[model samples]
Target: MPKQPYRFSYLLLTRLLLLWVSATFPAQAQSVYTQETALARDTVPSFKRHLPWLAAGAATVYVGGLVYLNHTWYEKEKTRFHWFNDSHEWKQLDKAGHFWGAFHESRLGADLLRKAGVSEKKAIWYGGALGFVLQTPIEYFDGRSPAYGASFTDIAANTAGSLAVIGQQLAWGELRVLPKYSFHRTPYAPLRPNVLGNGLSEEFLKDYNGHTYWLSVDLAKFLSPTSRFPKWLNPALGYGVEEMVFNDAAANRTLGLHAYRQYYLSVDLNWQAIHTRSKFLKSAFYVLSIFKFPAPALEYNGRQGWKMHGLYF
Candidate 1:
């Protein structure tokens, strides 16, 4: 009978020991979950977060290959049809000249921001403003380049381009909301020789009013990281449209207008090498293509536009 009491005591002690063991190591309870996961039976949704980057990676590879092939063609014959635009180049200290230079680049800057996911209002105004402000150094650099010098005409064109970009964004409502399609409206401008006549300088010509509009399409593909910089360079191919409208003073009101149309295309390859994530670098070297495509119509002018050889962002 005394043994029966001892047996009960032993049973109680056993239960107490188990309780203490469980309390001492709570992780053992979670072991089952970890083991199941280790066995590849996990049902959690962790992979969903990385899906977008994976897709971007695959697309980058495909597009990078295509861009490389196009780049080769641009290099082969870029120098033959080159332009000497000394007229637009200007000095930095010259206040009026600097503003014009900024204006032209700003127009292009708006187009850049639109492509890089900036909203229409900010993209246009900000881009135009930046273009004018930032391009001053480039003009100054041009003065130093051995092959090319500075010109006031280039600055003016830059300003015009900037205004055009901002104006287009403001004028079109959907463009602010939807960029890809909004920028599709072929941007156009006319380029006329600073001369007084329309290819007939011999004839009596009057002060003419002419214009030039440039259109460009921007495409991008992000690549996987290879070395120090991100492994992608976004290259854009731009097709240009040139139109000129001049007045004929000699023919009275009967022959009032003279017009000319020319076509131009350019390619640029851009890489964000230094400060790739920085806002300024992104804005600076965003597009890498800068070789103009040859067109028979533009040949009459005898020179191609500026070519983008290489850039560091």
Candidate 2:
């Protein structure tokens, strides 16, 4: 099986967190009524009383998941600490991915904490830290692995991702720029299954050749409130790569292909901007907000020609 790192850690944690929040919702319902009526919330549900158990359970799951990741990702052989400068690979595209993942995880964790009644400052800080916590454990194991070692660049990128969210929120009290991603099948992916991945599920994570990460900045938020910028529209800047079957330039020469950086200017829909009376629709949009809405784009590559995308995200 091909390696699919980074995907499992966050997806699992988010699901567990959602479950945890859902389970605690009933207990918090009384507080909602109290706030509406200006009355004190005097009764605590039995479930809330046992929340320590839920916390313990969450800890157990996290530990188990980390252990499993270490066992599965690291070989039995012992290896010394080492480092990799993956900044060379994919024309620094993977770094964009690191930032992308870290940003979402940090933001989601913070939002989830807020929903759980954590203080805003604590939620943002803890959520930002959680991104590093989730990502760094793999590095400890990586440092010991002969096949893969800890990369300071990755850690830096992860911190950037987390702090990017924290900084934005602390400054403006809302996210003006959001990290988003989109992908399309590429010929390069099938050529190196062991590294790039063999299937759709694996390829999405491992195939840097196919992934495009974006920073979707809300134009409406940036402009003066009275400006004519559409509130629902976001102008996105994107980073990606082309023809990167190998990590280094020399290897790519053998295939008669040059790996180059691709830059994109695109438009995306800010789904969260949509206002609606239906709670279900709002929740659904929120759930799907992680994805950038597909729209037309124009791209410029490093010494590659200018190109147009009729539908891009």
Candidate 3:
């Protein structure tokens, strides 16, 4: 993908986010139930032989991609120092995206280290904070790019995102409330396909109205042991925005459509809580877990009245 300056600079955070959001923390988190689970996880031996090739391979590809995006693909954008930009585009949907991306990515990074036999502390430091590391390099490129300035807000959000995971893992040894994401195709994509979704690829990236970031609380961890709640269930609170044909208010007014914030209450599944024998299936589930499994939802829009979904993703 070609870099669109501010547009695609931080998408890697999402890559990292999904990578781990499905997977939980490193080797430290002790499972409450099932012995087979323990054997599959937390039993990783040292991977010293693999580390050299793994590290070198990852660095080469990542650094090479950075150089290509900054100097080659987006060459015309020019290189020059720029000031802080809040962006505040897509009605702060991008900011929420950053938070969601960083949070998940940090956890995923930690999981990778754990899979490679790294200890909890080192994994937490590097893996849990990988979101910030992943983001800063792009920010470094942006700071030097004339097309977009380095955004202090973005940096702060990325830091907070990484910390949100690191702090929880260190304190609780597991996530009590996980950050999850869901998206539905919006009507606006048809109104302005170029801006919203020219293709399936662009839709997920640029269609702000199509995205929702959620805090899916695992009450099983927080509730009393005597409580009847199922361990596999989660209640989700979600945030989204719509009518953002333009990123700014004045620009959106030209289209005569008002922006509105959206809130959702829904049930979600904590797939990790479900026990299974196959390590491969568990691993697949962990990778797939960043997505909020479809469920019923109650929603309130800032402009429109309340609505309910029989099933919302």
Candidate 4:
């Protein structure tokens, strides 16, 4: 009985010692496996991830929105407005204005592509192409609306805006461009004439050499939203930092420009354009009244201000 007790104690001690050793040198835990993770979408879907789903959804919504817009206008919903339609004149491809406009649109498209996880080159190309292609469909809808006749010049402007964006990417691919200058609202006081200020900003630049782009952070504030904003808003703001890089060789080269250059910030402001009622027929379909067109905008930067222009949406 005494021998048997000793043997049991020794066995117990050995087991305890083994457990301690195992605890001291633990193995690395295996990563979780899932389709989204395996496909490189940790939490969100990539542009390529679930592409069929997105394609179906985007196509459905885009076409549906167009049809709805037309239907409502046809039914006399009186729910559309164009703040800038009359302010700008149209010039075709030969016009310098066309180039600038298209360049801007391309930049906008590229930015969207980057968020969708596309490579920078693809982003720029896709953005420019999207900017150009999106206009035709929009123009078709406009032509169908009795309240709003399709203007060839307007479609041309859209194309020009997109081309301007592409040109900008080609010229300055280092910084991701944002709307550096734009005006929201109207005269400071409509009763008071000659008040010319209306939310203007300058000293901003974006350059992309296929790999990296640089932007002034301080100025990015008025043009971008914060992280809390919806990802779709694509909020961006910073003071000074190394921007995203797509090419190591291009970023490392010293071309007289600072590895990261700097720019001053300037912005001006004036009156407000307030719309009191829902103008578009689609506005009434919103579950919440807030979704209606011409809903009050308590605070707006120029980017959001662009939404006020019915054609831009």
RMSD of each: 30.4, 4.9, 3.5, 27.8
Model 3, 204-261: lDDT tens digits are: 7778888888999999888898999998899999998888777667777888978999
lDDT of each: 0.32, 0.69, 0.71, 0.33
Instruction: Put the candidates in TM-score order, highest first.
Output: 3, 2, 4, 1
Off by over 4 Å in 2: 1-59
TM-score of each: 0.25, 0.82, 0.87, 0.35
The lDDT of model 4 is 0.33
lDDT of 3: 0.71
Instruction: Please tell me which predicted candidate would have the highest lDDT against the true structure.
Output: 3
Superposed model 1: Cα runs more than 4 Å off: 1-85, 88-123, 142-149, 174-313
Q: What local lDDT does model 4 show for residue 12?
A: 27
Tens digit of lDDT per residue, candidate 1, span 71-150? Answer: 53233433322223543111111232233234434544454344344455776678667544544334443344344444
| Model 3: number of backbone collisions | 5
